[model samples]
Target: MAVHPLSALLSGLVLAASAAHANGDAPAGGEPAAAAQVAGLWCGDGLLHEFSLRLNQDGEQVEGELLRKGRVRSIEGRIDGQVLRTQSTKVGALVLEKQGEELRVTGGDGPIALARGTSFRRSPGATCAS
Candidate 1:
């Protein structure tokens, strides 16, 4: 049986988030209040492709994953002032600026706009094995 592209991407993001929490990078219980504004899941619906992103911000350090059709890539970067700068294996370097509940990506193959979505979130007892 072949797994759906979205399923594989979600699985990869969950594993990455679990690892980050275990390594003391991501907050263990929940996202901190300070980072809540930029944390959680963001989704983008484009003409040709749809993308899902999970971002965990611990102070200035940001770690996350991006999932698109045929691709699952980890992203690492930091929040510099008002913008979040990250680099992905699939998309290269990108700059994200939050505008209300949306994130605007300017770099890589973007100008992509991702809106807040509830499909993915960090639970209190989330683990890699789950």
Candidate 2:
């Protein structure tokens, strides 16, 4: 299958964030930790579609892959305060408000509530790659 362009972009963003973190270039404050808290695999099941997202967050930057109906799209965004704002080629702009462990996604046709997928693993050794 041909790789999606958005996937490449998101992957680059993740790599850049990792490099910045490694270089100690990440902004100082609680933002990094706060963003880190949002890093995980999240899933939402609807009557018509099942949505899954695997996110890696460092500082205010977020990179992830969203899967719905067997189609994978890359997500790139930033967190400001308690809201995570992201955009994808397929979904356009998406706003997710953090409420406890759930992310209420909006800015789409309809809203979706995504819960942390505790049983989902991004890799064999990594629970959710960061």
* Candidate with maximal lDDT: 2
Candidate 2, 1-130: lDDT as tens digits: 8889999899999888878777655644413534525687776533323666788888899999887766888888888656787864543557776766666654442243233222222233333223
Tens-digit lDDT string for candidate 1 (14-128): 9988987776565766453233256776765343236667778888888887767747778887775446777645435677666566566644433332332212233233321
Worst 10 residues of 2 by lDDT: 113-122
TM-score of 1: 0.50
Give the candidate number with the greatest TM-score: 2
Full-model lDDT, candidate 1? 0.60
